[model samples]
Target chain A: MSTTVVNTGTEGKTWGGGNEPLKASYGKMMMWFFIVSDALTFSGFLAAYGFSRFKFIESWPIADEVFTHVPFLHGQELPMIYVAFMTFILIMSSVTMVLAVDAGHKMNKTKVTWYMFLTIIGGLIFVGSQAWEWATFIKGDYGAVQTKGGNILQFVDTDGHRVALGDFVVAEHKDRTAHERKNGLWFVDEGTLPTYTVDEVIKGLESHENVLVRTQIINEEGEKTVLSRAESLKQIKENGKAVVEGANLYVNEYGSPLFADFFFFITGFHGFHVFSGVVINIIIFFNVILGTYEKRKSYEMVEKVGLYWHFVDLVWVFVFTFFYLV
Target chain B: MGHEHKLEILRGLIKFKSNTQKIWGVLILLSIVTAVEVVLGIYKPEALMTQVLSMKLLNWIFIILTIVKAYYITWDFMHMRDETKALRRMVVWTAVFLICYLVFILLQEGGYIEGVYSSGFVKRDF
Candidate 1:
């Protein structure tokens, strides 16, 4: 073997094996790879959501009608406003994150610290807003009745305004109560009972002259099919099986149970991403304060984390579109 | 550590002085898109409700706008534009192709399942 080393003349070129072929550091390139994989994971979830929505195309709930509540604005039907605000908050955080990266490039520690702080604040606000939205979704506004065939039956007045079950439901004195493990079965316990029973809803429907039943089925005009008064009474008395309040994996006062499942799963997943992003930001934030990057003379760490943060915001844009707007 | 950014957006129709400025510009564009989406969602114009390619025109607009927002968030916010061409292609092309395939297959399957639900022994209508 020759003592002289062979030269391929590929060193420092774009195709060089170890010379940063992508013009990105190992850590930053790995971050991009992670982000791409994560993007596919989110797309899987969203496509599953699309599958379910298309499966129940005719009976799917309208997002505008479902997500109408706003913070501190009770009894008002303002749709899409609160969600729009949340989108703005996430986008603003993303902007601050990129600014932090820009500051990192310039080795401006103070600017990076402040911008990172602002980005963290924006993320916290977004997570908090999402929690509020989830709470409201769980504690649903207007309760609906579930038919034996697993369909939602909502109450509406003559003017097509939704009427809450609480407005007209009259509780009848009954000895029946929720089944508890201590009360009956030693190993089985039932879920919390809804406030009102199906019979009570039927009774209220009979007494209320203006209230009518709206089926989950959509008509030609893309509205829920409202039954005639007589048909409404017959439907409730004969088919109504239980009163459903709020949303759960099994039951939803919305049109389909699948809708609630997807909402909880997809948004819950994205919220987890936001939460982890905040935690990572906090860790890097402390490092910045301690002059870790200042000593290293490179803020590439900040740029890597910024990529993750921006990925979270990107996912949210799609989530907001598929969940709310579309 | 000489990191340079391509600071022009909208096919170089708009240019910015610095990375910070570019971020703000992208933010403004995203916010405007979101505002337009919110307004359309709230109003739900009848003209846009008409079906096009088996979907409502309004939905098509929303999806297109969402893609646009995603583009800016990736290209600008994530600094994909400044990265090497190989890196950008590796991330963007893989994601776009796989997502489109997944969505197409799932949606088609869902429509088929709906047909089965309606026409099969298990009747959906009560």
Candidate 2:
């Protein structure tokens, strides 16, 4: 009896029966697999966002009205321009990343370095612009009032122009003390005070007869539903609870509180990706400077990072569509 | 690609001896698509906003254009076009299937919720 182990046509000592079925190396294939899973994670988040948006379709904030600010052009109604520019910049960074990968293929360290530098710069600009956008969104433009039913009520003049709270709200100051956890009984603390109370906003509305209350609901004319002068006074006097000046997890001056939550979560997640991408690019940039890949006779690492950068850009495309365009 | 293979792009339709030019070309295509998307979003022409197939026509355009842009970014910038066919299918097909399934489930449920909200059976006006 022959007890010799048969070759079984798999002579190598590795897995996969000793064949690269996809014709890709171990690293590249694993990277692709990781990307697929990550893509699914992002899809899950986007799907949740879609569900919530659909749930509140009628009262959802209009993307144009919410994202009207453009940097260096304060108080201008420039819709979709700044986000488009951010998209363009990220796409260009992906281009430079691919160029770096191509240069790495040729063992041209100089070109690789230059392209990698440009990619890093582009990433920095994207992250910075995103921060600016978030700040602007959080700080909100014109303040609004929240109803007891948790609806945001904005003010618009007779000409359909928005009116700021500070424009007409008389700034009356009264001595007030914040209750701190340490100083207060039972270790509870009062929340931060808003710039104005509901009474102040109601008084402001009464003083300015031209101002009207605009609800978040859309009318048949595709504009916000603006109440009549009489209705505005009645609505404010009856339903107004607190003055909501900006966006947070609990309140939003835009429309729905969920809108602010999703905006912060989704965009913050994407920005985190861009942040990590920049860090990875910087590490690879240093490796290129060190001539490590050159010595290895391959620039596949740069190519891998290029894959990730492009994926980030791809995700942004969908985000821009779902969050802004659609 | 290894040291021996040249970095040609566009399936050799436009042979980039340097590969840098091909990168720029792909970028331009993506930028054009994005420009169109932004213009459509800002203007939102009346005709396109008409309802069609359970969704607005403008929204469909945005989704389709977004998919096109994603394809280009993956195929060109990520060098998926240069990889083996089996690898491409394995990665792209799997993602497509899962994403479609996920969107189907969530959006179906979302429509149900919307119906409930509009039907006035559920008291959400707290």
Candidate 3:
């Protein structure tokens, strides 16, 4: 509300001093401002993600295919199951937060403490689940090829199942220098490696008569660029490995490496927020147990935390829709 | 200093009335709207789909419904509905402007980056 200029030509005054723009409680008003700024930050991240998805509109990886892992259900494809669980947990925590605030109103210390504890536990569970989701995404599954045309061609079986590059690729024509005890000019020692090098796969393909190179795109109809059985065998030999490393933001065998980069950065940033929220919730949980707010004669602190908690849930709603559902 | 008045006021505010029941009715209606959004999100309709939207029409449904849910959250759950007009305007307007600003800028820049990436200059050796 605007204040009319008085006889003294003064505006509304805050408790501490005059001329404060916002005429509200210091902490509460500040919290609203902070939420506003934070919401923008999240929007920026999501917008970047949208841009990338638009760029690779034709060949972007499907969200369901990428995030199909479920907890304790090993090898089962459970698309968005984990994230859905996290959403439910956060929503339940919001309910607990409201209960704690209600208990605070009645001055019921035991109920407040218990409700706060439940909310804290819910937050922790959500953070842990998110961490697991991140781990699965970072590790990746069913690699693809980065073509010279900047398109990603992923391998799939005749049945339309995603085939690991390791399953179908065979390498041919690998050229490696003989291990010289020392190089004449560079005098550098051979770099040690963990597994067989790409050169080895190539060499192995060259020496072996059974493998061949198969190159073509697999369409959504579960059809591949057709090849005879003999040709398929020949292609496998030249390809060396059935699977090739796929792209992530760090490294992706996809269109632009930016896809993985945005995935990690945007989702990682949101995950960081959830993590911090949990820590703050833990502090509040301890305070509730200690009866700190009980002595203060108000459960307003719980309500404030509840506001923050719900904000996180609100953000996730958008994230899930944009990232997965879309 | 005014303990009697304070207690009476608190009691009055917390009391259940037909008015409170109406509010609950409104909440249920909002919840139904949310449910419809969820259903549309899950079952994407082919006929309603449009690529220009950058997402499925079903997804647009979800987004619109989510905004509605957000409105109820701030208005009813957070008690913004009862606040003075100035306070309500400050809260809603600030969020609306910033969110729109961020969305516009990010999408434009992101599209630019995507164009650069699609070009042959950068090799994606995934």
Candidate 4:
């Protein structure tokens, strides 16, 4: 028997990506390549967020204060508890993913299936919790007025408890005619009006003698600055420019509008990653049940997808730290 | 593939006979690290909050701990430690250098803009 081997003159060199010079499988290396580039994309977003946040560091909303809501336990100020739970779920999912990869390596189909199921469940819970958190943030708890200086003016009683606009502001509706297309102002629809107007806010402040205004600027004590009764009246009467009921791209009851923008963008981006990860995992889960990898005699597909799942979890670790902890 | 299957961690301080056990070990280690982070974030010890190197000491701790978590997730969960040195460096170095560079430039420019705003030249709030 004669065996002839031909060398294409490019052997023993790392010019082409075919030779496995780094001893990594092609698919694994590609996953790493995608991860590195995806990592840079995430870094860009987080860095820009950091820039805007540093610009208004003094008045930047404290993350602990902003992400204080928990589902089903309304009106309770449980800061970081739900987020911590979400973090734990995600980490546990990563653990399950790695375990699945390990089972795949051992050629244990049953264990791999169970671990994948667990990972998928964990991911679903985290995404659901994130959606609930987003809703709570959008609805907002306390309404605020935007000062002409672009700072937020929150209301509080003498006891320092936050007062919602609905609790004190008794706004009288003006009988203004609505703009209609038939009236020759087709493109001139009025913007959705806020629940209360600036005048209504000032009137409410004047009526509630016990209520004072709290500025967004954090004082030396690490709390928002509270103005005295007379100062509140003067500032609101002079500087109140717009009534902001809740959060949107332009206005945020929490404080800085940039906070809302970054919050929405970064978390939304991460949520998208989780969503896709879930979809991919579901596909892989179905394939695993069909014995697809078993027919191939190698579970490298499971391992490759496991790499992506872990990377997503890794990114979330940083997001949780920067967005919540830092 | 000439697999290097010596499953050891922490510079060979601990070795696992099975990959599953190793995964659990890494998971426990990561969980402890996260627990410490959550505690520090919740309590935020006042003593550790004193400014150091233009930032709070606790913030530095948070960043350091986050890096540690990232390292374990990559090296252990992703099997980077078992990978060849070239592949490891290729992925890790690319990400590390780019992220550091981007953060440095952005934060520097941001600080400059902040100074401009606070120097009484631009009236943003009024």
Candidate 5:
């Protein structure tokens, strides 16, 4: 038996096979579709974050106070400066990425290579900055106490300036031993203990006449509620349960646990995207150097990856606004 | 393949000589917007602190500027403006519509939950 091929005589039409309806190649169209889906995923994360913030609008952590540290500048309360620098770095990298794509469009190999190199360098700097920011956040500057009601109570001087527990807490040698697998249950071990005990903090508060307690709840003037000296002593002595040093999933000295959770989750996800974008750029960079695109007579690969890189930057713009600015 | 780039931005108010120039121009615009945002955030002018439609005026400004930055990044840097109208709408309209709906529903629900928490019916705090 024999088989014969059939053609519908519409092979070159818009709806026919191999027709470019959107005037985009299969790879580019697929990239656009992927980007749309990815945008939705990011939006879901951001919307959830917004929901949580709305829920705790009265007691949310102040972004400025939390992101005050800059590299090599200890004890300086310069808020929004470091984050602004990170934003500039990401935006600059995005600019370089588009430059690389433009050079690729012209099939200028030297220009493409140089722009790609700059873009990769910018990405590395942004990632490094993010890591440093995470470190500063996790190793909190001024420790606070977590009350039984899950609220944070921070110490402040009479003038409303924050006071660190390390400034006043007197350490007592009380033979406090860490629980280990060898000494305790075979499968159980305790997490790292806080720097100071709640009782120690209370005793320090009692001795420090100028110190007051500030609750997480925002008052009429849109600031954390600072209680009077007698009220501060009463609140801390009665309700304070644990000393919180830094941020984590369960506890954060930065007012709300949800804030830290979203901070880690959202920024971590975006950082992962930046990292993968850099890796892909490196691969494309090597391919350009090897004359792969020159031989293929098309540098659309660079354009495709450039779209992804710009998308990463776009997400960061929103993240920076929502996480830090708003 | 060589394709012509749309060189003008800001509704034809500004034009660039080439695609590279346009990229730099958009970068400058974005940087300026970010700087303004940082200044407002740091200073938090007392006038902008007034609540408008349940949000601070400063927050509104930041969100609008952020959207402006996103638009330029997509239209210029991603070359969305060069694409066909169908493709642009397919990518943009879908995300925008869905995200707005999701945010609306979630925020409303969050507000309701907050009311419940604060109304003394649910004792969340000790």
Candidate 6:
């Protein structure tokens, strides 16, 4: 098989004519096109995110406030630190990938293998970090009150401090025992979990006395009064139980169910991209170890992935600016 | 003739490197502008906040700064600046016209949605 080399120095070299950038073969050109299209796909996602923010102009949840948790530090509010670390990891991986490509240019096999290995590890760590972040977000904090009108009301006294549902849960109810997974009636034979039903939380809300529907206003500590202790207890009482199962999407003890939805959708989409990127990097990494590109006397494969890694970093820069900063 | 053509191509690549440096400088400037935007957004000045501009003075500043960054990213990082004039214009114009159209449609529709919410179609509490 013939390899194509493309060089920025050559101009007016038609498709079939000789002298392309880096002597890039057809595969490399196709990869470039793929990267461009993929870049556009990411831009479309970000623009849609921007459109939604514009749609909910006044009441959008502040991204910085929502994503304040950092790994390795429990109970400490670290803003943008985790995402910044992720950004650094991605950027550094790009650097390693680029170096590997440079070594490939000089036909240095050892350097290529070493740098490719580092880049793959970087990608794996990034994907793992993202998984941890998703877990934390899915298991939410400081839940909200659902109003009859489908509005989520979070609570705060005049002081504006987020009062936990536990603090206000003065009355208690006996929670029902869960049905075994096999014993439960299966509509289509799906497994069941031993968790409180949504009905229970609704009944508990009805039974509670002191709970008030909270709003998305800032409490004294200047946090979202999305859900208060009193309101959550009330929800459980109304539902005739103590626990609420399922995602706290709409009107959960958080003030805006839309906030959760957007959070899950946007970040989930980005996380999916990161996951796919890592998987692709893994394939390339294995190929590098197997000396596939080394046989060709070029590591343009690494360069191509480097471009993708940098593109991901570039998108994150905007995401951080808009989501975390703005 | 071949050697002269090769020299010309090498010179072009060299020139492109200097242009890239300029783009990097612009990126640094844009970074500073972004930081300013964050600060303004966080501690929104009362004057700017209360007497909003036609498109929000603060928001306009952010959009302009962001556009500047986008322009440089397209031109330098994507190397459109070094391409044939037709190629350069094709990419830039496409992005410009499309982004404008998207923003216009979105804002107009969004305003209508806000109107419906205010009119009690979707009741909101302040």
Could you give candidate 5's per-residue lDDT for residues B1-126 as a string of tens digits? 449888999899998998888888998899999999999999999999898999999999999999999999999999999999999999999989999999999999888888888888888564
lDDT of 6 by residue, A118-155 (tens): 87788778778877776776565554444454444443
State the lDDT of candidate 3 residue by residue for A206-293, as single tens digits: 4434433324333443123434445544444444332336444545543346767877777778778878877887888788888898
Which candidate, 2 or 4, has the higher TM-score? 2
TM-score of chain A of 3: 0.73
Superposed model 2: Cα runs more than 4 Å off: A1-17, A182-186, B1-18
**In candidate 5, what are the lDDT values of residues A44-156, reduced to their tens digit?**
99999999988888889989889998899978999999999999999999988898888888889999999999999999999999999998899898999999989999999
TM-score per candidate, chains pooled:
0.96, 0.93, 0.72, 0.93, 0.98, 0.70
lDDT for model 2? 0.88
lDDT of 4 by residue, A1-326 (tens): 25655656876677733666677788989999999999999999999989997788778888887788888888888788899899889989999998898888877899999999999999999999999988888888888999887899899999888889988898797765556667767777664567788888888888889999988888876678888999999988889898887687888998999999988998899989998999999999999999999999778888898999898899899899889998
Which candidate ranks first by DockQ, i.e. highest? 5
Off by over 4 Å in 4: A1-18, A174-192, B1-6
Error of 1 at A216 (Å): 0.6
Against the true structure, what is model 3's DockQ? 0.27
Candidate 3 segments whose C-alpha is farther than 4 A from its true place: A1-24, A148-151, A166-248, A253-256, B1-43, B52-55, B109-126
Fraction of native contacts (fnat) of each candidate: 0.85, 0.87, 0.34, 0.79, 0.86, 0.08
lDDT string, candidate 1, A224-290, tens digits: 9999999999999988998999998999998799999999999999999999999999999999999
**lDDT of model 6 at residue B26?**
40
Candidate 2, B18-82: lDDT as tens digits: 56777787788788899999889988999997888888899999999999998878887877877
TM-score of chain B of each: 0.95, 0.86, 0.73, 0.93, 0.97, 0.67
Candidates 1 and 3 compared: the better one by lDDT is 1
lDDT of 3 at A158: 49
Candidate 1: TM-score of chain A is 0.95
Q: In terms of TM-score, which candidate is strongest?
A: 5
**Model 6, span B20-55: residue lDDT tens:** 244334445545655565566556565653324534
What are the runs in model 5 whose C-alpha is more than 4 Å off?
A1-3
Which order, best to worst by lDDT? Answer: 1, 5, 2, 4, 3, 6
Error of 4 at A282 (Å): 1.0
Question: How do the candidates rank by TM-score, highest first?
Answer: 5, 1, 2, 4, 3, 6
